[model samples]
Target: MQYFPVFLNAQNLDCLVVGAGEVAARKVELLAKTPATIRVVAPQACQTIQAMAEQGLLKWIQREFDPGDIQGQQLIFVATDNHQLNCDISTLAKAANIPVNVVDNTELCSFITPSIVDRDPLLVALSSSGTAPVLLRYLRQKLESILPARLSELAKFSDKFRDKVKAHFNNVNQRRHFWEDVIEGDIAETVLAGDNQQAEQLIEQKLQQDEQTEAGCVYLVGAGPGDPDLLTFKALRLMQKADLVVYDRLVSKPILELVRRDAEKIYVGKKASLHSVPQNEINQLLVDAAKQGKRVVRLKGGDPYIFGRGGEEAETLVEQGISFQVVPGITAATGASTYAGIPLTHRDHAQSVVFSTGHLKDGSIDLDWPALARQRQTMVFYMGLTGLNVISQQLIKHGVAADMPVAVVQSATTDKQQVVTGTLMDIQQKASEANIQPPALIIVGTVVSLREKIG
Candidate 1:
């Protein structure tokens, strides 16, 4: 570690800032977030700094920064444009036994500010010891996407019950176990979901229960189409907390990487010609894992409820009495269509959207041809690549126009995404020529034509 990381309490502490430019203004803004008594001394002040001074947020001494300004201050910030003056300020602060930060000059900095993800009570800071500020900021942005905005709410809520929990579970290990379960289980989920009353009630109930025993639960999380960015904050949180992850083929590799590293990952992915693990076996595996007092995650791609067999898994969990929560994701139909620039519904084209699975249990392309053949409606078929020829022939034979536009989007929303477009009369041939693969979406409607205009 280049620098020992520490968080200082800024409340009611006198802090001195030497400058009034953009950098100093930004420093003041950060300090203002705390209850620090800030004093800025410079030859001139920016409009924002002057406004803050007039509003009594800070004291602005309109004069050149001198060694006297560093007196009686707990911390110092040197943000002046002049390099020599900044160095002089840093020297004075160090001489006075005060910690000082020289902006943009890491060599002179007694302390450096980190890129902070401020979820209030749950703050995450990233620092490169001033060697790579941009990299720190990039990492902060990644964390911002994964961490829930309302995570602080859970922290605040738990604070109210800390004493009660501490009193109830006197044993250190028991208390630690209890808190772990509470934070990784439904209590935290309820609080994160904005149900404070339910969360508090659940917390009380747990506290009243035997702290020696811990119950296990499962989360049915949608990993989204292909992009890990599409995964919900709740999904990411549960993924990291899971003790075991049961995933499928549709779940992207990038999405699976987000799961906790220590967690056991079992692949039950099913391909068109392969079933590595049967559906019943996968369901039983989740139940068995939870029975072992483990937090299990049955992660699926796309919206779990949307033909992802999540309903079946959820039903099995219910019968087995395993507690679980479902986190939705961006399904292929919406994700593929948008990325391919084909609107699923439009006033000038499609009025209604229909989603169907092209693959059937008994290996047959059985669908309501007449209903799907209707105009002014968009149809999206999942797992339909293998049955594209049948789908095209059936639709065209069932009173649908032979020239109806169709599009096949493969690996939708991913870098490998490929789109093949043609009329119903020749879509199968076009898809074959493009060599479109599985995990693709098939769109059949006039909306397919819009891809040319808007794509």
Candidate 2:
């Protein structure tokens, strides 16, 4: 590591900033986040900074920076265009044992500003040691998406119970374990959902309960179509805190990589005519893991309720009286169709959309051909690649035009995504020629024609 990361307490410190241009304004904006007294020395100041100075937010001295300007400040920021002046300020600050940051000059900086995701008490900082600032910023952007905006509110709410919790559980480990449960359980969920009063009550209720015994629960999380980015915030939180993750084959590798590193992963994925682990056994596995007082995550691809058989697993959990939470994900139909540039319902084309499964338990494709053949409605078939011929034949046999536009999106939303478009008369042949695999979605309707315009 080129630099050790540490957060400074600016509440009682004096900060000196020497500049008035855009760079200096940026630094001042960051400093405003803290409680430090700011003093800016520049020949001229930007309108924003001047307004701030007028508002008594900072003390601005309209003059060139002098060496004496560094005398009493605890932290100094040199953002002036003059390199010599910046270096002089840096040397003076260093001599006085003050920390200094020179904007855009890594070598002259005693400390570099890290890209921050500020959730008040819950702040996450990313830095590349000045070697890859853009990379650090990119990571910050990714984290910003995954983290809930109410995270800071949750943290603040939790802070109120620290003392009471500590008093209830005298042992440090006991208190820590209790907090982990509260954070990963319904209490955190309620707070993140913007119900602070309920969260507080839930926390108090948990505090009154016996902390000696820990109950294990399961979270049925949808990993979304192939892209890890599509995973929901609640899903990501549960995945990271899980003690064991029971995942399916349809779950993408990138999404699986986000699971807690120390958590055990059990593959219960099923392929066509091949079951690595039967559905019953997978349900039993979840029950067994949860019974052991482990936080278990049943991670599946796409929406768990949508043909993912999540209802079955949930039923088993209910039968066994095991507590579980279901977190919905972007179903493949919506994700794949959108990424393939085939809108399921367009105002001018498809007024309604229907989702259907092409694969069945008895290895037969039994669908409502009459309803599916209705006009002005788009049909999205999940796990339908294998039953494409049957679907195509059935749709055409039931008054649907064989020339209706159809598009098959394979590995949707991923880098390897492929879209194969053809008419109902030739879609199966086109899919076969393209070697489109399972986990692909089939869209049928006039909206399929819109792919050419938008794709």
* TM-scores for every predicted model: 0.62, 0.62
Q: Report every candidate's CA lDDT.
A: 0.89, 0.89
> Model 1's lDDT to the true fold?
0.89
How do the residues 1-455 of candidate 1 rate in per-residue lDDT, one tens digit apiece? 88988999887799999999888999999898899999999989999899999999999999997787777999999998899988888888888789999999999988899889999977887889988878888899899999988999988997899898888866544565578788889999999899999999998887777555456788999888999998999999889878889999988888988998878899999987679998999999999988877788889999999999999999999999999888898999999999999989999998999999899888899899899888898999999899999999999898889899999999999889999999988999989998888888899999999999998
- What digit string (tens of lDDT, one per residue) describes model 2 on residues 204-294? 7877776575678999999899899999999998898888899998899999999988778988889877899988999999999888778
- Best candidate according to TM-score: 2
lDDT of 2 at 85: 84
Off by over 4 Å in 2: 1-132, 135-177, 181-209
